[model samples]
Target: MTVALMWEARAVEGRGEELLAWAKARVLEREPERRETFRAPQDRVLVITWWDAEYDAKLPELPEPGDELVTRTVHRWRFEAA
Candidate 1:
């Protein structure tokens, strides 16, 4: 089975570009099967990675940025192909 992991965060104020760059640089370092990144209006950045493993398998995730870089806590989700 394959698992998809999604990670998202909102920059504190005017740091959306910084946060997005940081996420892009880190999200794929572990080298998953596939990955993509996105930006939302409210300084939100999202990264989704597809791994060729079971849902229960461990996977590397985008690490948290500096506390001052984000407004709220980062969010993550995992899903297995149905």
Candidate 2:
């Protein structure tokens, strides 16, 4: 089975471009080593990411360092493929 996850989140305050770049690097270099990944969308204030669908369940388990949005503007999606 293959899993795909679509994530959408915003950067807070000083965690803007720097944070986005970091996330992009992780998506481009690291995450795919574990599974699969789609290129990130570097536009607007939202940091969009895609990776293994199963990774969604591991979100809270990961180190969510950097800016954590305290607003309701964050949106994400998880999709699984057979």
Candidate 3:
């Protein structure tokens, strides 16, 4: 099975660049099959990692960034390939 994990965060006003840099620098304990990062107009950063594992299997994920870096708590989601 294939599982994809999504991590999204909204940066504090005017801190998008810093937040993007921070997200790009994070390294997972185990490398995923694939990973991608994206940003939006509202200072939102999104990271998606694809893994070769069952939906409920334990896997490495990006940790939350510092509170000062984000406007609110990070958002996460898990999905299985159809």
Q: Residue-wise lDDT of candidate 1 within 1-82, one digit each (tens)? A: 8899999999988999999989877734479988999999999999999999988997888888889899888999999999
TM-score, per-candidate, Cα-based:
0.93, 0.40, 0.98
Give the Cα-based TM-score of candidate 2 against the true structure: 0.40
Flag regions of model 2 displaced more than 4 Å: 13-15, 27-63, 68-75
lDDT order of candidates, best first?
A: 3, 1, 2
Q: Give me the candidate number with maximum lDDT.
A: 3
What is candidate 2's CA lDDT for residue 12? 57
lDDT of prediction 1: 0.90
> How well is each residue in 1-82 modelled by candidate 3, as lDDT tens digits?
9999999999999999999999999999999999999999989999999999999999988899999989999999999999
**What CA RMSD would candidate 1 show?**
1.2
lDDT scores of the candidates, listed in order: 0.90, 0.43, 0.95
Q: What lDDT is obtained when candidate 3 is compared to the true structure?
A: 0.95
